[model samples]
Target: MRFMKSFFLTTFNNHLIAYPTPINIHYAWSFGFLSLMCLTLQTVTGIFLAMHYTPHIALAFSSVEHTMRDVNFGWLTRYTHANGASMFFMVAYIHIFRGLYFGSYTKPKQWVWLVGIFIFTLMIMTAFMGYVLPWGQMSLWGATVMTNLVSALPMIGDYMVFWLWGGFSVDNATLNRFFSLHYTLPFVITATSLVHITLTHQEGSGNPLGIDSYSDKVNLYPYFVVKDTYGLFIFTFLFSVFLFFYPNLLGHSDNYVEANPMVTPNHIVPEWYFLPFYAILRSVPHKLWGVIAMLSSIIILSFIPWLHSTETRSSRFRPIYKIFYWTLVFCCLLLGWIGGMPVEEPYITMGQVLSVYYFSYFLTTLPMLGTVENNLMNYFNK
Candidate 1:
């Protein structure tokens, strides 16, 4: 035990003494630490909820209610776990945006950022499937509708949907499988977290300068560790408040009731985190095309490193990159907003336009910016 303690202490000391990090990382950088804090909170609260959660369809709904009303602090467990999902997504989005703003996805750390994106995608899947476990109206139909999307494929799509459901429809087998996957995916994500952190330490954190091995870089300890701790405190404070008081704030009222296959939800919006990509799916006029576009939106994010061309790390020095960056951000927001509205001709048209811009930003605009910036830099040098 002494040896273990000493090893940790020494490791902490080494990281603390490493270097001086840039002071310009901004509040955006706080999100990564906040996300870590949120993960812990979610894990703890989730474990408690699991103790009272019933996996069987017959008892799952009542089991949740039992915990909420009967078990000691069961309500707290329920609310915290539910609300924490929202908090997790909130911090994750900020983390991803911070990476984008600082070019943290560039070489050396590309795999780290890619892992982060993978975690993000997995998180969405986990949350989506987990939300269905309560056996609520939205939970049932939402699972049904979303899973049925897999059937949109030509040959394997129907088979895939059937496989996911474990039956012809969203029934007992489906719940059991979703529950199993939901329980398992977090561990997978935890492993991915290790990869993310290892890669992060290898490349070191991206400073506001976005350059590698710059004199401005700082050690992970006293500086960021301290700053990260502060963010954790803030996150903890808010999370505690939710756990104690407003735990259900992030959940839908319909989820409290048992799932009724006969009753379809009027407006079945998935949890907020899935809104943007879900919107992208709803935007397409063609069934297959919608699925393709929605999936492309996610997979395309990984290609950003190859696409973005500016020689500089930070967008601060690249005027064109900054323009394109903000444009992409706006387009994403637009896509998200359109995703919630009723599917219509105009909305579909708008989604297509934004989708075009979205891909263009990756495939065309970023490359163009790099080339244009290179030319300008050369001209100035000459």
Candidate 2:
């Protein structure tokens, strides 16, 4: 019993069960731990699916069908994995935005946020690779469009595309490599997430009140464990509902058709989670410039902690900033809506307009808010 108690003190109990937590955290904090749980679920399901999956272009689609129709409970595993990816992103996006709103991206927490971004980048890469494993219509066309975007670069553009596909275009090599990466990247995310959690625990969780606690910390055993478990149960229940009931809700009908290299779909769309950035990619007139615009949108996320220069942390304390923040959120939604529309007039125009506002919020509003907001509000006061 003594040895067991010593082992417990050194292992799970110390690091997980009894870890320190901020007393003032809310449901938003629950999403981070939930994202971790979702990742585990995704990785486990993916491993089992992989055991039966064939990554060849000829066999990939059929293998997926075989897994779904022939293998024992394979349908459940595949659906869980598919729906799990969406759930993972949903929780992660909420977790990220919560950090943004509550100012968890500020100074000492900067490393934590950066590691979180690393995890996100890996997730996107992993998901993109996973999407192609089915070798369906959208999977093929989507892979083609995205990979061909690399050819827009100046000199090495062709080389970049060639290097990625290992051929003139996406084929068996591409499918084989994508499957390998899809199987590999979750482990990367898992390792990076561990670093993120360690750094976060080291920094301690930020609170809504934007206050840090040196002495006010609470044990993770009961309070937060129960709260996070409660949140996970609700989240899992809702996710399972989609898994069993509306399995195809987040997937596209186009993907139901198998690959035909000679034929292209009337319209190609990436997944819903990627829509806002996809809209940005198509908003510009020039192909190369459009590619840059899309990359810029993502690259800009890393600089947010430095961009909004202020002593203030949380948007809760800054009334003016909250308005701008919500406007940015609205801009993202508009971009997403525009992404699914035909690139013809009003949609293109609308996408271009919203794209400007998206950048403006980060590049203009945030930097300028510190200088003008108080004066503008004070002028109104007088």
Best by lDDT: 2
**Residue 75 lDDT, candidate 1, scale 0-100:** 74
What lDDT is reached at residue 350 by model 2? 95
Regions of candidate 1 where Cα sits further than 4 Å from its true position: 1-12, 15-24, 237-249
**Model 1 C-alpha lDDT per residue in residues 1-382, reported as the tens digit of each score:** 9999999887666545664556567667889768776777777777788888888878889988999899997877777788889989988987887788788888877898789999988988889889998888889889988998888889899899989988899888988888888888888888888788767766777777776656655565567777777877877888788777776676778887788877777778888678788877876768898889889988988987887777687888877788878888898888877877777778888987887888888788877878888999999999
Give residue 257's error in model 1 in angstroms: 3.1
Evaluated at residue 70, the lDDT of candidate 1 is 99
Give the best candidate by TM-score.
Answer: 2
Model 2 regions lying over 4 Å from their true place: 1-8, 373-382
Q: Total clashing residue pairs per candidate? A: 6, 0
In model 1, state the lDDT of residue 356.
84
Clashes of 2: 0
